[model samples]
Target: MANLGLLIIRLVVGLTFVGHGAQKLFGWFGGTGVTKTGEWLESIGIKPGGTIWAICAGLFELVGGLLFSAGVLTPIGAALITIIMIDAIVSVHGRNGYWLTNNGFEYNFVLIAVVIGVALIGPGDYVLFYRP
Candidate 1:
């Protein structure tokens, strides 16, 4: 039952991340694609060029989400997710306060916490791939 719970969480969170990445990478799902994503990244101070960062971030989220959902290299996926969320918080959300309604860090924080929890808890039994 716990494993079932874990699977559900991973699927929801992971797939959501995939969609987010697609939005950034390919402009799918109503996203602005690389150009706009890059501009936004620059607007938020990501630095060194928004296009590069956008691609990097998009790849990280897309691949990380896929790995996370498949339960393959779960820790790595969690780490990737964690890094990006932390970046989002510091670069964009931290100054907005805690409540998401204010465009704050709340969402990013939750994502960080959830991925950390998933990392500590193991990917559970329904995984398509397992490291140990």
Candidate 2:
């Protein structure tokens, strides 16, 4: 019962993060490649003028998302995402305030909490992958 809930949350969040990473890493979901994304990052003052940050973000989101979903390296996964969300709250969402309707940090804050929850509570044994 509880395990199912945990598994679902982990996987859904992990897959979502992976999808986001894929967008940047491989341009799978209309995500710009590292080169273009690098430029975009520079504009936003979020990423430096190189592909490293982009690569890191993509990998984190990609790998973090996957591990988070599968309940593998879950603490690390949640930590990675929690940190990222913190940055998001600090960098972008801070000025927006709370509440998605007003374009605020509420959603980002919630996500950060979720990631932290995953990290702390971990999967409830419903993990379907990473058999080892």
Candidate 3:
């Protein structure tokens, strides 16, 4: 039962993040793809070239989320997402402070913690990728 919950949570969150990444990286959801998004980030004075960082972030969120959801490479996927969230919290959210209501890092911080938890404890047995 606990495993089922974990698996469900992982899948939902993973797919959600993956969709967001797809929007940013591939313009699937009308998002400005990596190039434009990167340019925007550069315009805002973030580290690393806009395109590079955008690509890295997009891939991390997309690939990591998908893998985590699928129960494949669970550790690697969660770890990557955890690192990305940490980076976001420190670089982006931290600047806004830790208040979710105030559009701060609180939300991301919690998510990072969650990712770490998922990484440390693999997803539960309820999975679509397996039949056993």
Best by TM-score: 1
TM-score of every candidate = 0.93, 0.88, 0.89
Candidate scoring better on lDDT of 1 and 2: 1
Q: What pairs collide in candidate 3?
A: none
C-alpha RMSD of candidate 1: 1.4
Alpha carbon deviation, residue 104, candidate 2 (Å): 1.6
Top of the candidates by lDDT: 1
Model 2 regions lying over 4 Å from their true place? 128-132
In the range 34-111, model 2's lDDT, one tens digit per residue, is 887777767778745447778877888888888888888888888788777776677667887888887788877888
Please give the lDDT score for candidate 2.
0.80
What would the TM-score be for candidate 1 when compared with the true structure? 0.93
What local lDDT score does residue 51 receive in model 3, on the 0 to 100 scale?
91
**Candidate 2 minimal-lDDT segment of 10 residues:** 123-132
TM-score, cand. 2? 0.88
Global lDDT of model 3: 0.82
Model 3: worst 10 consecutive residues (lDDT sum): 123-132
> If ranked by lDDT, best first, what sequence of candidates would result?
1, 3, 2
